[model samples]
Target chain A: MTLAAASHGFLSPTGVEIAFVLVGIATLGAALQTVTSRQLVHAALWLVVALGGVAVEYLLLTAEFIAWVQVLIYVGSVVVLLLFGLMLTKAPIGPSPDADSGNRWAALTVAGASAAALVWVVVDAFRATWIDLDGTVQGSAEVSGRSLFRFWVLPFEALSVLLLAALVGAIVLSRRGGDAKGAAETSAPAAGEERH
Target chain B: MHLAYPAVLAVLLFCTGLYGVLARRNAILVLMSVELMLNAVNLNLVAFDVWLRDALHGGQALTLFTIAVAAAEIGIGLAIVLLVYRNRGSSDIDRLRDLAERPAGPAGAAGSREAQPDTGAEATA
Candidate 1:
């Protein structure tokens, strides 16, 4: 289908519009939950919702490769690992006492200002240029993958090393009580002590 | 030529996620908020990619890399959050004040008793 037909054609236009609205609503809902949820796991789940919404948006734009990557990398791996970390660390399962703090107002003010600035910059930059949205991008994995491994190869390799180091660091940090003595010292007394 | 829909959605998602990052104290929640913001950016990228499909096709390629990098980031970010929780006895951002650059765990001279022990907190507190 031509770009104009996909956008202005009767069935496609309505279909696209409905998809856009639904995706937008879902994204907004998830974003709200990601911030306001008291439990860490709940927030992570919301992140999944938000990320999934993005994937759906990509699908709407006919970028199937990018959409699947969104699912595989973000929703599947990232959020799951995040939940694993929360469980392993034993973050408070119940409602956290101090979900919001005294500095909330300050943080909000700064975030608001930054967002405003970003929005202003983007709007000003694109004020005159009109974007044609009923277009298709040849985002097949072959094209994107080749480019990433070619001209972007150095940065990609650097990122790999960085990730490897981070993985090793995580293993070492989390496995601190590796020896029996440290393990015993770490947990033996905690079984008996109770604090209010 | 109407890009208003995607733009509005992107702005809304970003603003809401920003609010969450600012309002939430749990490290995991904060990380989730970051994910929200990233998704908003992804939407913008794909939208622009569709708009400029006949051009360089840079946005879609960048989005692919972004997804990969985001996954790796979450992996390490979650590990750090877990490590902080283990050392601080709590994951609340308020309680993690000692993480201002130097590692503030038992490796320092904070002493085990005074140092935060997440297991201890979980067992007793």
Candidate 2:
């Protein structure tokens, strides 16, 4: 479907666009801080903000289910997992001077160059494209569930298998690591009992 | 809304993740950045799925899959990192560069050998 570019000028900003731009700005800033923050925990906190902003964006795009999933999976669990990992790894509570690697400037330059090129290409390629969000609710839980089960069931099942493998792999990796041989040996019978 | 909005946002977020993966000293921080990059791609998928109005909603399905995969990736990645830290006594990526080809001869090799037992003993203790 060819949307009329002449009618939808860039100057004519709709309410959705304005909201999107504002939230997009906040999301981008939060993302910047997530990468650049000197304090490790602060970076994870900033990541929450960024991911939440993306969830908000999903809501704005009328993807209600995706938005909620984004929140539940990302904000609710992923960030918490990251925090636990940080603590388990004995991350410093205060700011650490060496949080950044030695190639910071090089990384910045590479990121900047790629961002510039990608932004230019995207803006240029999609200048005429418009998203018609006023029509059917494209991403309601009902719609998402129907499509996910109908057409994507195979992959969904495969994904469950993948997740299970990851689960077992993680357990064994941490359990049988050289550092915890005695613990793993003791836990073996317990694991076997649990399996039954 | 113009598709460019989400597209540009995804691009910037991906690049932010690129920098993080490149510049972070901590293993967990690198994983966080990887999540950022994956989230950015999900945003793009959602936006385009909405724009194209795909009948099967392939983009959204793929997004869900990507998110699940990312979760799995993080779990496995953290497990690996924790194992490394247990063995090496540090989670700093740069310091864990034992695979790097060093020009130094037996001195460096002997030094690494000497340090191994100490780290192993510390880990067991």
Which model scores highest in TM-score? 2
- DockQ, all candidates in order: 0.40, 0.56
Worst 10 residues of 1 chain B by lDDT: B116-125
Clashing pairs in 2: none
Clashes of each: 1, 0
lDDT of 1 by residue, A1-196 (tens): 2544344433344567678788779887877777767767777787788888888888777777898988988888888888887887676787776776667787778767877877777666654443454444456677667666666777667777877877786676556455653666565654322221
| Deviation from truth (RMSD, Å), model 2 | 5.1
lDDT of 1 by residue, B30-97 (tens): 77777777878888887777766645467776776677677767777776776565555677786654
lDDT of 2 by residue, A110-178 (tens): 999999999999999998898988899999999999999999999999999999999998998877524
Among all windows of ten consecutive residues in candidate 2 chain A, which has the lowest summed lDDT?
Answer: A187-196
